[model samples]
Target: MTTQPHFFIEDSLLYAEEFFAGLGKITRFSGRTVTADDIKDADYLLTRSTTKVNEALLYKCTKLKFVGTATAGYNHIDADYLAERNIEWAPAAGCNADAVADYVISSGLNLANKYGFALKDKKIAIVGVGQIGKRLTKRFAALGCEVVQFDPVRAELESAFTSASFADVLACDFITCHVPYVKSGKHTTHHMFDKQTLLKLKPETILINACRGEVINNADLVEVLTAGHDLRVVLDVFENEPEIEMALLPLLEFGTPHIAGHSLEGKARGTEILYQILCQRLELPVEIKLQDLLPAMAVDHMVLTEKYQLSQRQFRALMNLVYDIRNDDVDFRLGLAKSPDSFDSLRRNYSIRRELTSLKIYCDDTLYPTFTNLGFNTSLIKGE
Candidate 1:
């Protein structure tokens, strides 16, 4: 009898244990706590961004032939080292694009509402126009915000998008970064927003960083904030990760533990992509569907009973019922304060978050098209 391959997966991957049960024997360890010896006998190793995959971790895994990261970013994995050893590796790129876009929209709209500024009157500068950046541009444009994109890489290929300079991006009312963590090269994103860059921003600018923590220097940011800069900052990713600078919390309009891409659909999509890749490599049938692994939605449908037409504020409130930034912000602040060392634990224990695609909204005709375009399942209610 041919023995089934053994797979070791990170504990944070949603539905991983259940998804891979029939395919092979599985063992799961905390992503950050995983050691080289833990995966020594495994044929496959699946990890998230927390665990670093390099020579040290793979040295003991003699039987390991395949490695996969269920994330769009592959900076944690040493692809060069894997290629040298003839180990096939796969990363789920653009898997969480929609999730991160949703985060930007939710937070942006919330800030606009709080500051009493119309989104249509604001200009948003997107630092990178990759999968997440494209989604953000589309959504913000649909909301009537003037979108400026800054991606030389994509601008060189696509004539439709005229790239803006770094100085031009800083002049916008809102600046959101979606660039990958590029350590070297002319377009390097490491400390892209350093002391000099941060100094260029106007006091009213709202800065958001969800791409990578190291892309923006936290120390410089803290110094700027401490000096009484009036910039509204929102950070989902940090430089040192779980060991985040607690002092920066008070200065931020919103803060979350790198969960902008942790939506249920996104996480499931990442796992499914890797599953398909692994099946092809092992010559096994790809029979799994991402939808099959998802549990029932916590909130399937919602009804809006408004006397008059639905305003943007009302729409935002209804959307918040589905997915609220404040919940994550509050949970992160409380959890982190109580347990400073439990940064990964906070992410691993994040509540079941669904994407906008998972929700159905019943609203007036005025709001039907907008909500539908925003990826919500919407039905026009005849009665106001």
Candidate 2:
């Protein structure tokens, strides 16, 4: 008799059940206690970064021999403890790199145009040179921007970048952080950019944080803004989700929900990679490709100049052209701030978002000239 592998999931991947059939008998659970119980009788368990997997939980899973997390961050897993127990662990590293890069580039370029400064020749200091950071460097460089990097953990990578110290990064014209959360390490990024550090930034510097919140103390940031610091703060992620200091709300240049890496293309890629890894570990052959898995969506060709004539709400009109996943997140975050207790509900019911690739644009005949002049694509929606 062939040994059957029982697969347990923690209700996070949010993928369709039909897509996961045949690999194993899959069971889904949301509550921690219930999920833990399921893990005890399963041979494999899958989870996201939000679920904490440590020794205590591992000890309860006597039948578990493999673990997989469908997220870029794996800090929740106690690797040292898992190693001693001979359990295999895998994470979807760099899965959302492109998605994040898209967010930064699109938002950055839009802001640049608004500020009257050409993106070309502007210098950027990116902290943390990991998968996402490296991808951002390439994207920014392609747009004719000078990129400097600072990642003490990866000194060897310095050869590819104009690397400098943390102080040097703070002084750059634009600074974006991509560091991970490390609680107890020489390079602990928790509250790394505090009030003292914020004061050092040039008055006109553009400060953007898309990494984990608390990486920069929100309280300190609020104080800096209140004290007349000339920082243009753009945040997609905050120290506390759905909670923003009322005083600081008016000071932010751009604030949105944590959708910087929530693109459908990115999420699907992550899921596909997780599927492959899980199959290999379980000794099953799984063939999954992102292109084959993604559902194509039609893109409407937007004539910026003509659309400019539509409504008086400039932001909303422009947003409608490319509006999808990220915009929904922005609304959800704002809603959460109004109703803090509804966070769980907001996350559970998040609408499925698609990448630009899923869209096919159709430009108006007369407005085609306007789209060409604005450098907007009139043919298709390409991935950034």
TM-score of each: 0.87, 0.80
Candidate 1 lDDT tens digits, 1-384: 999889999887777866688789999988778888888988999988888999998898889889999999988999999999999899988889888888888898788889998877889999999989888887887687898999987888888878998888989999999998889997889999888989899988999999889989999999998998789999999998778888888889999988898898998888888888887887888887887676777678877664366666866776686688988999988988898877778887787688887787887876676777676777877554
Candidates' C-alpha lDDT: 0.85, 0.69
Count of backbone clashes, every candidate in sequence? 0, 6
Weakest 10 consecutive residues of candidate 2 by summed lDDT: 307-316
Q: How many backbone clashes are present in model 2?
A: 6
By summed lDDT, which 10 consecutive residues of candidate 1 come out lowest? 303-312
Quality of model 2 by C-alpha lDDT: 0.69
Off by over 4 Å in 1: 1-3, 35-37, 157-161, 282-285, 303-309, 339-344, 362-369, 377-384
